[model samples]
Target: MYTIGQVAKFLGVSRDTLKYYEEKELVKPKYDDENGYRKYNPYDIHDVITTNFYRELDIEIKKIQEIKQSKSVTDLEHVLAEQEAKILEELAYKKRLLKKIKSVKEDYYKIKEHLGEFTITEMKPLEVKGEITEYAAYEEYETIRNSTENLKKAVTLTSARRVIHFDEEGMKEERFIVVRKIEDADKNFKGEVLSHPKCIYTVIEDGRFVNGEKSIDHEVGERLLKIAQDNGYELTGMAYINILLTTYEEGLERVFLEMYAPIK
Candidate 1:
């Protein structure tokens, strides 16, 4: 027989841990009335060693108790199989999360490289699901939210607005719409398609706010027109804006956007 301290030292565990095991009925140490202390026999020490072995595998205390009291090999096998399946499921989720993180990092780097730079490029066709407007009701907002939630790939949250008409004064009417790349769209989808074969693309950083809402800088639109004329490209009067990201600093908000206007 050994004292609690002796067993704890030999097993490399605390005396309190041995006491806790005793409380859990994992190890029943013999109490010595004359000495006023607990005494651990070889059997009690063996039980503690087995408990530590299960703990090394990260088995929960309650589950370890179940394993200790298991009557058959099949019962033990079932519990272990459940744990294996849970681990595999968690691994899959972690893999997907890692992939998303890597993709977002790549996008951030790309934005930094092309920020505020203008170029002539062709964009793939997009399917407009619905319009996003300042005056939209809560029910309309919920409908759009539910629709995009089912998509497997990331959806473009904003396409800014389409220029309905342009005149000497300025744009006559503008309609804001939500769009996604055509490839990711579902079959039987009935919506307008926006395709720009050749367009002036540039990223704009806006920090203006009005009535607690972000407002785009119209000066950028004037600049786009000027640049297009200098390059001898005629404007098609259609503008498509894809918001890249938003950041806040020093109680101010900054919005980065990918702006495109069709050229003829």
Candidate 2:
């Protein structure tokens, strides 16, 4: 038998921790009437060591208590299997977050070079398999914001968020698309797949789309239309504006977008 302090030192824990385990009936120590001191048996010390080992695996105290009550090897196996599953889930979540961080960093740097300039280029086809939902302009920002969370949650992993736009009777309408790579076979989002054909696109960084500057839109839109027409290309559909970056300041949204129009 060893004193409470000796048991705690051997287990690399505090005396309070042993007292807590005793209160939970996990470790019981005998009280010495002669000196009025608590003494833990060797078996209790071993149990404390085992508890420490389980904690290193992030097993909760409740689960550890259940494990202590386990009667068979099968019960122990079940507990370990559950722990493994939780670890896998945590790893997958962290992997997705890391991917999002890396992508945002790359986009952040890439857009700095394209600010306030329009360039005509050949854009490759976009083959995305995920969900698409349209949103009204300047109407119920909260509704859209909630939907964004739902969409992001639905996707197991996402690489891009594409917002395509069109005008209907002078009202701006947007299509929100959240897509993952083809390799993400375990993707949970069950939405329509979007396939954009390769096209000659006039890509530019314009804040007027989300910032609500109609004057800038009218001027830039007309100039872009003329540029396409002069270069022997006719715009055939609504523009697909893939926002490269967006920043919010004082409740105002500013976006740098790359617009694509199918040309004939």
Candidate 3:
């Protein structure tokens, strides 16, 4: 038998922690009434050591008490295996987060690299006729492609001569294509006539199209609005994005996009 002080020294644990364990009924040592002192036997020492080992592995004290009481090797093994699986899952989740962060950083760098100095230009309101489809992003494009049958029906049925997109509320709201007739258009067609208000236009010309992603520099939009204000033009209505041409090479490695914009 050893005093609480001697047990604490031997186990390298504090006296208060041992007292806490005793209060929790996890480590009950015999008491000496003569001196009113705690006395720990060899069995108590073994339990304390085992509890400390489980605590080091981040197991809850209650769980350790349950396992200790049972002393079933299979139950303890299951707990350890479950904890290991949880650690693996957490590691995989963290890896995915890191990948996403890296991808975002790469996108930021690409945007910075491509955004050149701004230039202002004036655009005349010209009438165009063509088939127009609502612009869709990545996966949405696939859905649209399958639904529209590669846009053949949209172009043929409307007799679309030209297509244009107008940005509204951070997204392309109005997509118009100049067609022969606006009467009794199908479900996909919003037959409302749209026009741009008087505003100076900003333009950028890239020799090649940058894949499926539209190469309209939004920073140019800001510069254009400033220029329009300086040059006496009231900004009204949304800006129009016009794609002149989209060509893809046979290898799928290269794509070209020619886009123009008219801001109002």
lDDT of each: 0.71, 0.61, 0.53
Q: Tens digits of per-residue lDDT for model 2 on 1-264? A: 899988777767988888888887777778899997988888888888888888888988898898898888888798899999999988877886777678678767656654554455545433444334443333433333333323345432223444533332332554555443333454554555544454544435545445466434444446456666677766654555565667776667676565655565
- Model 1 ranges off by over 4 Å: 1-67, 72-85, 125-168, 174-195, 208-214
Tens digits of per-residue lDDT for model 1, 17-114: 99888888888889999987998889999999999987776667898788888888898788778778878976776775776567557657757876
Q: What is the lDDT of residue 25 in candidate 1?
A: 84
What are the per-residue Cα lDDT tens digits for candidate 3 across 145-206? 33222222332221222233333333334454443222343334444454443333322343
Question: Which candidate number would show the highest lDDT if scored against the true structure?
Answer: 1
Worst 10 residues of 3 by lDDT: 153-162
Residue 159's lDDT within candidate 1 is 39
Report the error of model 1 at residue 119, Å: 1.4
lDDT of 2: 0.61
Off-target runs (Cα >4 Å) in candidate 3 are 94-220, 224-264
